[model samples]
Target: MPSLDPEEGDAIRQALGLDRAARPYRNHYPAPGDDPVAGRLVERGLMERGAATPAGLVLFQVTEAGARQVGARLPEAEAGR
Candidate 1:
């Protein structure tokens, strides 16, 4: 099982929850710089950052493995997709 530091784990959890309207993550969580945890997640294919929008927001998406790591029971809308 892959492990993460508390902060990294928190980020992953929030991403998987997929509640941006209520939570508004970008303004709150600063982007990682040379982040080892983020790198590890990428290396393991657990998460991916999409191209930045014109507004400079980089969309983050969690892979199935990442959701499983956080024990997220994805709803039908999000399941197996």
Candidate 2:
């Protein structure tokens, strides 16, 4: 988690929608070039670039491991395994 401290786990979690997805969820990053966290998440295999959305933008869905990290579970359809 270089450049991202342990205290910032919340930020990463929020970015992954683990915190707000209690009501709903979607796959994405905040913006382009916001790669630091994205890179880290990718490195950990906690997130991945999935198919393009209707607008052709890449979707970043959280992996099973990522959902576990936030004490949530990815639906069977969304689970990587």
Candidate 3:
């Protein structure tokens, strides 16, 4: 399997279909398969990992770069929501 990389952040962002302004939703969640993508975003400085609660809930938030990336690729997958 291919690993998620900075080069692919845009693809992942497009897959997320997140709105720029309303992004970084407090309760925003990523699918199981998006872990690798999230890692890639982190590596690219496009996303950051938020503190996990004691309940084991993992938190992640997108950065400005992530938002721009998603916007750039919006036409690709028709904005993956």
Q: Residues 1-81, candidate 3, lDDT per residue (tens digit)?
A: 234455465444543444353333332334343477667666777666766756665555555555565543223332333
In model 1, the worst 10-residue window by lDDT is 21-30
Model 1 spans > 4 angstroms off: 18-37, 78-81
Q: Which segments of candidate 3 are over 4 A away from where they belong?
A: 1-27, 30-34, 72-81
TM-score of 2: 0.56
What tens-digit string does per-residue lDDT give for candidate 1 at 1-81? 657667666767676543443322231222453456565666777766554556555555566676667665444554444
For residues 10-78, write the lDDT of model 2, one tens digit per residue: 534664565666621544454333456665676777777555556555556676666667666665544
Comparing 1 and 3 on TM-score, the stronger one: 1
lDDT of each: 0.56, 0.56, 0.50
**What is the clash tally of candidate 1?**
0
Q: In angstroms, give how far residue 29 of model 2 lies from its true place.
A: 4.2
Candidate 3: minimum summed lDDT over ten consecutive residues — where? 72-81
